[model samples]
Target: MRIINNKFNIKMISENFGRYKYNEVDKYIELGGFIGLKVALEKGKQHVIDELKISGLRGRGGAAFPTWQKWEGGIRELDEETFVICNADEGEPDTFKDRELIAKDPYKVIEGLTISGYMRSAKTGAIYLREEYTYMKHELETVLELSREKGYLGKNILGTGFDFDIKVFSGVGAYICGEGSALIESMEGKAGKPRLKPPRIGSKGYLQMPTQFNNVESLAVVATILKMGASEYAKYGYGDSIGTKLISICGNVNKPGVYEIPFGLTLREIIENVAGGIENNKKVKFLQLGGVSGPLAPESLLDTRYTYEDLWDLDLGIGSGAILVADEDMSVIEYIKLANNFFHHESCGKCIPCREGVHVYKKK
Candidate 1:
């Protein structure tokens, strides 16, 4: 897991970089590992949610949904048995930031989940790890055990009477399972397919109980917001989309690793400057923001800012925080064909539009 540090990089979540080894519970605690959970416990649930609201942090996994609203929705639900799920299903191509976060700082993610569990009064939390990351399951389990021994997890955490514990659930490598409802379905031991939404996951999910799903990055940031205070965390990014985002840059770029960049940086700066420009000095043909499902942009649109408002205005999104650059060597038809092939093979075949529509496009 390579982290690129630059003038544009902000060390909110990645603050543990170079400071501690992975799985070192004591070292993590030295650097304020469970401070956010402590803060959440001390300040109370509403204070935690209020800090998130003031922080202006949105979901880091594609959708820029307000973090506070999701937590609030879970609170409003009357279910006594609710669940907090961290979506570690990094099924999208070229997006590995979540995996990196889990590998490098699993404790931060655990703390985030614990804070969320406290906020939502959830007794159980789960990490929906993608199957490809099965190797990490053991390490994560080890960390969870250590956290429990140290009183960070398990019954009556820190004497706060908040009984919470987390378990890792691995997916069967289905891309469609990345969807919120579909992920819940897979967690429930059913076929991984998107469910029709009338009662949203916030209302009924995961064993037909109120459930709150948050991306790995989104939940991780929750701890940071609580630790640093909302006003402090909100100082980093552009309007509306506050805080830094972890982007996984691949394809034609020279530096093709995960980067923690502040929002509002131009795409041109990201591709040419942060990512070390096109490989072999080749001319860029197009760029894909988010993942394969994201919209493509020609070189002409490279100057656009990477904010949620800016991307949404152009009918694009920062989905999955994947920036795939294609140079002149790759043809537009070839790229579209490759993307269609992925959808065709990975579609859960639950809906006619996605199932049949993807097949038709692949055949074309």
Candidate 2:
């Protein structure tokens, strides 16, 4: 639960992590907790979306899709029944930022989801909690209850007549359910499996209604963007990839924990300055950005910037923002084998390519 890079001054979500007991509603409000929601209610829905656009806040859930576009689509759908979901089924290996967010600052997520519901006029919001995180479910439920008592949840939030409520649905420990469509399906009481695109989650999702799906980190930042003003938040990150990102660095790093880092920092900077270099002062062998499925980068690629465009250019993705650093003592083949085994076990077997490909790779 260690957080670094606080001195850099770009701590949007992590700003109040250690300042106070954020889990309590009063303490969170003392440090500007639901003020973003209040601002969103005051400015109206379109204003929120516009600010999100100006903020350049892409989806933090690996896809890096435009957050504003999804909200725009949900508004345009014209479906009376719309749903907003916070994808908290963080099954990515070494990625624990979402869990930390939920445990430390559940109110931020609740406010973000409520604001999202306001954006889409959605009555229902869901935080798809991972099964491994079930232990925190009671704590979250208690917070939700407190929010309801405080008039943050249920009908007529903040005297604005914007009625929204959130429910926490624990995942069944299926990694594939981390995908948007599969998460929707699982919520619908079906087996967790990825759904085919075309009727993207924007149009037909969650009981065949227009749904806005956002990752835990993506939704969490929504409140920050609105509270701090989009222009102010947008000034933090690199071009296109604006605002800071929550990166969970582990595997041979001296400081293995989550760090809020501004975009455009080199991989070497993150590994060395941020994570305090490799463990035992060993030389670096390779680094895996995002997660197990993310591309591997040797020491030669350490200079590359961590922006979305830079990673995409190298066929790399900031999937789940999990950085697994391997020292010279580790074997690349063994690492790949471990990753392959994970995929082989986690694949839903609905898609032939992923299903058979993982099996074949495991056999190899």
Candidate 3:
């Protein structure tokens, strides 16, 4: 599964991407697309759970929370009809990994969501697509129909009594909808805003039912773990960062594109080897590991690697793997101003603190 990268070789998740053409279900079958769902059917739910627990895969949308831990809480604790949701809003400024995944291999997301649905014993699944991606709705709908026809989705999938179906909920152009609870709200025909949690999303989400939602990348990896097995996937990453991550590198790079690389690669290595170094041979002043919310890493820490354990030690959150590199000439003040501007516009105005804080900062 060699990737078509402009620069250096990336040793990660792009292997099976673009293998099939335009929802060609037969090609998907031949190339082993829904085999993960097939494997999931054979392995059973507990096996699915245990395998992910061992694989150490986490939510790739940014939080980097363990996959197993999330499922364990919902699957083990509650006894109610659950729903599986996929947060495809992809509202982050620099993030494009989800878009690429869906655009290239829409089936992978379907297969992953289907597997997740079966695992949760869910009867329904929904992908909350961002409003900007409304154009993809027809294509996605076509893909869903194809999946159902191929027996990957719909009632009694693959001759198993695991009845489930999916829908695409094209949401408003609100960045806040990227949050699971907020997405759930949007799905429920309410204003898309983050919910206050004591009864967290897993306990009471999406119509006040037990809901399990994952971002596009995390669910896709569920399919990977089922097919390749946990230990095999675990072999890629070092220590706690035990799997490949889909990184979308933009801004001031020689070759800018998404690359799926294993954990433990330093920021320097990624910018140099993976991305072919800075754009136009200009010196980089800093790198923003995640999007606007992610910490600003100085050029001195270019050696810093992107591992959950290592990043946690630095008190940095990997909020969806969108890396932006800036040259030495870029002013930090201008960066701050731009960030404030985005925050100002995207504040949602649901909360006074968030709204007023940005407004005050702009005034000051």
Candidate 4:
């Protein structure tokens, strides 16, 4: 009973498709879920990293950096304490998929981070979730505890002599903390703000360790790609950018939730099929392709594919994989003003441009 045009039924990492319903473990066992981890335990470490390089998977977060490249940075670094940080802060107003993933399929996220921790021989890993997602934090903590008990986390994972542990850290509600450096800082018990480069997170993060930070979606996909050979995962998306993306459809969509679609799918198709189109069949006047940081695209360009290259052509970004739609009758200026107010209120006063700019807008 699969939709012909949409491949939503296909499971990404497991036969479970990250289902966290009651009795998920028995369901995963019935459908052969977590087999990748089992196979990975048998194959050893290098094979795992090799599978990821061939996936052609770029990060789904706003910055579509190649996942393999990010992993390589930590893998090749000459450091004893390499780390992985799952960015689940989800501060973007238009973003919700991270929270959804955390709440619905926390084990999958943990699985991804666990796999990543194994790949880099990470001493420690953490999921930086926002304090607002209190329920999600609780859910993930339980999953982590379960994983540790199953010998899939903590020392000697899967009896393979791998020692890695994961912690769930809470962010105190700053959008800037969604950035990797700020996330690391907040994890270190400092104010959430960005820092200058040279001694970046990968080089010195989370107590001055070589760190790699990836969004919740990116890490989840990495786990899937690592499990299923890279070539198989690359089959879904279009051209050079391979694999699917989970987009958060909100504002005027009918069936709004986290919809996983291939990269080359058209915006119209996403709106019509994935999101169930606009409310009352109203014409979409403008679309916010990414999060608030992105520019609005005119409706005339709605047919464009939601690929990274296509987005760059429109002078827009796929920030946080957020799709915020606006109706024909809605006022764009007023919407911008509202968004501006949020930025103003959240500014932490450490940076000049963001701090002063947000203050100026607030005064207006």
Candidate 5:
């Protein structure tokens, strides 16, 4: 999704979206594409991790886990066959942010994964793309090919003697595959269902090799942070949040699209200023923050800052950074019905509450 020009702070990963086309390697190079990896290499390995630690970058795929911790864990795993994976299966109902990152700045993701590969000492990287986004697969593959030819993805990258390569793994159209374990299981030719942790992704991820699996946005932002430096990149967000966030705003909004707002913006500011206010000037009654699993934020919470720490106090999350706004005319029951129907379909019959609870709501 090419960002429609708006007077908002869409920095870092999204600065080049509509300004330039990312179809060619030359365009990417001219616009400073692989500089992050170059700077990362120059900063030395430990400092690279240190910068991530200082950046306060968190996982963007709903998990809200700190990016630096994941990187540190991956680095700690001393397996030669470790791998880095990008979860490109953007299946969240209101979340389509990852697709933009993949479609527009494919090379950025490549550079991010390459940097991740170096950090984790992993020689292989994979992007688990959604089946519906097959259109972008070819474009991303083309970028990767050109990157390899230009000494970005192959052996002896930039003559650093570090070898890493990336491949796109087409998904099987299962929402559960968004889970890291399920994704790995599907990749291994098995049913895509959540597996027990303990043998976590870092220890026994893809093919039992230590893996650092990050969402597309998370890894792409890693590339951006590498270039901007921790302190400079930390300038945008609210107290302790510290970064920009790509929020996919939909439903009852006048200009519904992805808007990259700095973290900690009130829901009102985003819905009013960023999304051009609610559609038809209708008063927003409630919001579905994140996707179905996220909180049902009432209008009273519109003033609430968008942050994991703040939202968690109210039992909410920044799941994929998606906000679905509903006007006063929208029925609350209908929303529940839709949520129940979706969860009913997605329930893998793993637990009683989720398995039977959705069904009960559907019957109501």
Candidate 6:
């Protein structure tokens, strides 16, 4: 639990805010929020990627792919116009970690993306935020504007000449838009739909340019890895599953809040300590680890470590950091019905899989 001793040196946003309150504009500036950009500019691109690669940071957006590898491939394969997209379209029903990052510390996300842009030599970055969370999108935009005005987001950022800028492109309210390829299509002002592999997005992505797509949490960790060496970061969790995770604990919990805990933290610990246990004095029956697409984990696996590799054994995943603790009263069938309804309504009706799939679910 105590990751940092004498927290001033702790570069991560969550670590710095243990007892500190979010009060003034000066509070963030003093806490090394955008300092990563300055460091990246001085140190250069390869140094940034090497640090993340050593940190063993995996993607927090369900798939848990290596973050450094994604950046490296995008940089090496693509030209200067290579893009970085933060998939803030958190359409997962109960997941709100992305929203929390956008609301509480938008600067951290921006800082991380700025580092990536500098390293990849990217001209543009996009934060594809969900339209449902209008307030979060607005707040993120305000923070971005403030950073830009302060010379953190615009040309000659921190006097490094590593030019990068980020824009918030609100999606037209579709859950599937969270997918990397679907996001690219949406950004291109077309209907959001997944593109086929063979020419994967990393090689040819985002308006036909190689793009590195990361969830908000994954990018936020990049901010810390830049400050703390990767070896030190790897000490936190399992092999290939290093660094902490930001999970949104909701549904039937006495307290529902997003907590950034180490990777191996148990499900029980999350439900009892972080989420303040079950609601209405009810007993927890089961847990839905990811969002709807994620497989359900029974009570027997409560002691399991919340990691990508561990979840993979059960054919489940920590998709989108959505930890829904279902009480005995919650109906599984009803929940499925609701999720199906969402899919049905949001389907663009373009592809056979989505269109016919939605139709079948709608009829059900």
**Candidate 2 — what's its lDDT?**
0.86
**What lDDT would candidate 3 get against the real structure?**
0.83
Put down candidate 1 lDDT per residue, 233-302, tens digits, no spaces: 7777777777788899999999999888888788998998789999899988999989998989999999
What lDDT does candidate 1 reach at residue 299? Answer: 91
Model 2 TM-score relative to the real fold: 0.94
Over 53-145, each residue of candidate 3 has an lDDT whose tens digit, in order, gives 888888988877888888777667447888999889998888889988888888888999998888788899999889999989888999999
Clashing pairs in 5: none
- Off by more than 4 A, model 1: 1-6, 358-364
What RMSD does each model have against the real structure?
3.8, 3.7, 3.8, 3.9, 4.0, 4.3
lDDT of 2 by residue, 1-364 (tens): 1122453445787777776553478888888889899998998878988998898888888888898987887777664798899999999887899988887778888888998898888899998999999998988888898899899999998888888899999998999999889998899999998898888888889998888888988878998888889988877777677778999999998999888888888899899988999988999999998888888999899999888888999988888899999999999999999998998899888998885563433554
Ten residues in a row with the worst lDDT in model 5?
A: 1-10
Count the clashes in each prediction: 0, 0, 1, 0, 0, 0
Candidate 6, poorest ten consecutive residues by summed lDDT: 1-10
Name the better of 1 and 6 by lDDT.
1
Native-to-model Cα distance after best TM-score fit, residue 237 in candidate 5, in Å:
0.9
Q: Tens-digit lDDT track for model 5 on 287-322?
A: 998887787989999999887778888988888999
Q: What is candidate 4's lDDT per residue for 1-364, written digit by digit as tens?
A: 1123546544563334455452355454345445567666788667766777777767777788877777766678855778888888888888888877776666677777877787677868999888788666666777777677777788887777889899888888888888888888888888888887878888888788888888888877766776677777877776665677788889887888777777787788889878888999899988886788788888998889877887887787677789988888899999999988988887777777775553434555
Alpha-carbon RMSD, candidate 2: 3.7
Greater-lDDT candidate between 2 and 4:
2
In model 6, the runs with Cα more than 4 Å from the true position are 1-13, 16-25, 78-80, 196-198, 238-240, 356-364
Better candidate number, 4 or 5, judged by TM-score: 5
TM-score of 3: 0.93
What's model 1's TM-score?
0.94
Highest lDDT: give the candidate number: 1
